[model samples]
Target: MLIDFRPSGRLRGKNPVDFDSAVGPVLNALAAGRRDVSRMRVACDWVQYRENFRDIVDVRPVLPRPDSAESQAGQAAGAPGYDVELAVDVRRSGTVALGDLTAARLAGDDLDGRVYLEDWGLAGQSCIWDFNALYWSALELWEKASGRGYEQALPGGESDARNRGAARELISGLFTVWDRLAAAGALPEELYVAELGVGNGSQAKIFLDEFRDLDQTGERGYYRRLHYLMCDYSQYVLDLARETVVAHAGHVSSVALDATRPSHSLGFLRGKTFLLYISNVYDNLPTDEVAQLGGRPYSVQTRAYFPPGAATELAASVSAEPEELPGLVRRLLRLGPALLADSAPEHIGDTDTAVRFWQEAWSALRLEERYVPLAGLDLYSLAPGVSGEELRPLLESGADVRMHVSSGAVASFVDSLPLLHPFGRLVCHDLFVTKVQDYRVGFRGPGKYDGSVVNWVNGPLLAHAGRRRGFDVRFEPFRHRSGGNIMTMTTQPGD
Candidate 1:
């Protein structure tokens, strides 16, 4: 007789990570959740593991398939989009108030610094498991509050009141969208979930929590059973992820690797199939670069929105506009009549500022008209050291960068100087990002109404990066989705 532990997957029959037959006792001990290392031990009943990649010796989790999903269409696409659509058409695109537009932009920066990035950095550290003996014990408190299945946060109204509210709001928004996306085929799998620009592994924690199915005995592949992997360029951040993972089971950290070329540096990626994600990291990586997928199931999530000012403020230490944030938000709400030439018909007389604004604003508006595109277009661009901040400024200043609004035509192939290197397969999702120069995106005045500028940074990246293969992708019109782009397959890679 055998008592089974571990959760089921989208597929049936074989358990994705069950070591029941191989390490029966080990499974029992781990499920018991001992506090000390010596207290935990697994005893497999006469079953010996033959595989090298998975074994009871390690006492870790090894997931076979992707994470599970919950199917739900975006609840707001219909109503929110409809309201914004009418506002864009009748409100006089360039004549709106500019009072709060500046403030809104600055808030994006603040959000990045004080909120999103900072909290995430903290969550990545080893202290995560400190909440309770079981890593999930401490985390589950927050997960229940947010509606997204994340177990690593302190819930709202906890002793740490401020931390609790922040965790609740942020995780709730992120996971609700994420779970719905995975259910919709946007996220590949919960087990192999990867966040390309995982700021703090908050999203990764949700992915793993889902894989756990709220039970330790619920998933297969112990000793190799980790379900989510996070990567970040900053050691300061990745160190946190290492601590969190190692404390619960076992993990490696302090590895240096390039995002675009993760193949050479990413070790776990060696033999397993995985779901990949990239968020808020595009500006740091060159536009032409992409992670090489060797026939593995993966998705890239990116956030185009300038998260609320508090979120962007985490990087305030490195940003130039840290102090100007409050004042900028003040300008965003008003949108017009002052600061923008379009507010006054007579002011449209082509002064450099006004001319630049009109030109960029109109280009974006034209793309907005193409919101309901006639057909998919392949787009590509090649430039060096051009960051997101740089592009936004140029477009606002009237630079003539052409938005590459077509499908990329290059043969899909990974290049290398070392004679011949091989991989299982190659898959590509080439997203056509908006040429920041094309749109005079504004919260107000003659430009397109920015329900929010950072929407592109958040929504598109998270949405599409979570998009699975063979699934049709579309976004709400004028929702500032997709980075105003499209993702296309370029080739069938050869092994």
Candidate 2:
């Protein structure tokens, strides 16, 4: 895979290992601190390689703390995206190949303390063996006369390369963005999240499991408390999501909701405040010109499959100026949590990607005269909360991003569910905002990283505002995606 040097200065890579390879310091930390470190794991969904981490098979490296400030700071500080610190605190002083892994803050004499992370690098390529393992395993199977007969269909084989590429693209590109926000999602106390277009709940499962094991210490439910609500237009999908969460065991509550007209009860909506949300609905939304892309007729009909057909359909799930969004978000904040939503740019390939698609798509929508508050609204496009620094990469890379200022009603409808925020938001104690991301410049989308947008959304622009201020907000973007998103602690916004 090729590494794209981002205009933002963050080095872009093909996979996690490329990132780990660049940060050799983390690898060094592990080798050096062999004694004190209790255990460690790759933390992210993919497994990481340190020249020798595999040697210690019996030792299960605990999943790196998902929420932490030190980890989120580097990108906020404009460090290159491909390389970030794989931070961990140890009981004794030691080091790993990735970097100088060390002991955490003492916070007095308490043995139990939190570790602080900093930037580092490793020498090897890190990867997730699970995908291929599953794919290969399935291939071994063949249908039998009594039951069923068929060759095991491996998902990551040469035959499934396209799917694997799609999977990798989906994960490395889109998921990384979510990973950045997850840290904030971890910050909240009680959180409710929603999955907009949850396809068979794959991403939904990933996040639900994440929440099930949220960061917590010392007995008493060792993880933050979470109440999850899932919604999908597909009843079958909703059923799958419900089953997925329930089967996961002891940590999440799931429910179904509709994007067009949310069927969730006000009691549930009013009852629980939302924290973090990870949306991939845009993956299903249509990409067309709202009017024109940067004053141009931004229209492209790709042979590619487009997910969202129009904002109108998506708007169906929301109220234009939902009065409820703010209250729910505020409540979640008051309760303590954040949100993260995932969206792919309308046009996913080549230059002029989906810019014209969204621009034209919006204009084409025959919005109902009833006036949806945030739904069918795109004020965030004209006025976004992301910031000039933030928008810069998307603009430089010509990444198509359509900003929206969804009204309260629509925003509220979506806000009512429990969502997933990536690791970045959850790990940090405080948020650091910036317009530019070093790695973000690669798959760079168009637009200036607008702090105003980030600021605005972090404040008044969003519907989920607890009675107090907006939130302990922070913004860190990665292989950036479509639609604007926010990452908070346990509870942030949306439902």
Candidate 3:
């Protein structure tokens, strides 16, 4: 059979390895060795291509330490370390290319620790979305200073005239569902609706306002019975949302929690919620992408990089010796620009300068991609003890599967199912790519949006995962907006 190769990374056809050709010998080897043959095997050897990459795999001091200012200053004054070639192990399971591995702090570490990808020409390539998740943890400070985020500054404001029409479409559907539940005597004493990523709370106000209007019609007192839970990772956003929805305070409750791991924070409402509402949140959560090359699947690896000449002055302060870039970036995010400068005044200047430097550095960040062959389908943990084979439908779509493996989205989506009553539904509106063809066109994003990461979610993958869990997943174009790419995903029980 002739093979078709789908290169998720930039290095397409540079290495013409076939999936079937590469997999069969490995399978045969496993069989001869009396090993399990039910796994997806991959064939790869570290090719000696010295020109494209420098080998620093054996460098000393794999990570940076929290040294004194004087010590870091002395290190930064030294010559830069050479970049290395590091390949992480890929197991039989279809996981852990570069994106699945937790980031290390240095280049010579067990895993490739460098964060800047532009130097390696991997800038703008697709990566696992976890970096974006980490990046948002720092935005609470930025938002405090700027008083804005993705939602507040969303193109034309989230509730603009055009967007309001979509809100109506959303509420109309909710009205229909509410009517069905009330008529069937299925509406619980306290009807639950949880909105993840409440943002600036305008969406909640709009939703609550609409619900109140619907309640005025005297259908079944659903509005009075409504218990709306606003959930978000940022306390800053949550507090703001609470204020926005102050008029509906009696019906509203706020939960500061990670949208990805909703189960940990939302376990109290298991099977009690009627609707789990999410808007533009899933796209920001952590995700991993996988691609099939010549029929054999490979997980994509990514590292962050700064573009040349973008933030040269600030970049110079970051240690390029023991590879202090990731560590420095982490410190900058965690401490904020002021504290970071305060802590390292020897080189990083003062608060105002540091803040400016931070913005410059952030805008310069990019991504690099590398594809790693997998051993089989056993290593990826979809659920406890579930094999990666369960995800094949999502990955092996015949065309090159540049799948954004939104593990967080899957976790949140699956966990939220228990949050819903029998007839309850989970409704989410976000930038979603509902087909494989969408990916073949280009990389969706890890787009920087005012200190936050905005990516078009892998809709097809999430739908596939939802189906595996016995839920009906459907995608519809957002009716309120005409030009933007917002799609609504409504999931309910297949039964």
lDDT of 3 by residue, 1-495 (tens): 111122234234675434443334334433454533232212232222111211211111112223446335644775222112222111221222222221221222333433453232112233323334434555565555566665565666553322556566666776787778767876567878888888778888888887788678756577788889999887767888899999999999999887767868989888887778888888776666666644545555666654344435455654343345556666665676758877667657776666656665665554545555554556765433235676687666665445666656777777778777777788888889988776664546555666556668878777877787789999988766678778889999888
| lDDT on C-alpha atoms for all candidate structures | 0.27, 0.28, 0.60
| TM-score for each of the candidates | 0.28, 0.29, 0.70
Error of 3 at 134 (Å): 6.1
Our model 2 lands, by Cα RMSD against the true structure, at: 24.7
Q: After superposition, how far is residue 72 of candidate 1 from its true place, in Å?
A: 55
How many residue pairs of model 3 clash at the backbone?
18
Tell me the tens digit of each residue's lDDT in model 1 across 1-495.
Answer: 121121223124653333333333333433353323332212121111111111112221111122222101222222111100101111121232222322232223223332111111111121111111121212222233334432221112111111233233333433454456556775433223344444445544444444344334523332143444565555545655565555433422344445545555554454342334443333222211111111111111111122334223422422325444333222212332134344433323323433233222212211111011111111212121112222222223332111221111111012111111121112222232323322222111111111111112222222222232222233332221233232322111132
Please identify model 1 stretches exceeding 4 Å from their true place. Answer: 1-193, 213-224, 244-246, 249-254, 267-271, 287-401, 404-495
TM-score winner between candidates 2 and 3: 3
Query: Alpha carbon lDDT of residue 464, candidate 1?
Result: 27
TM-score ranking from best candidate downward: 3, 2, 1
Candidate that scores best on TM-score: 3
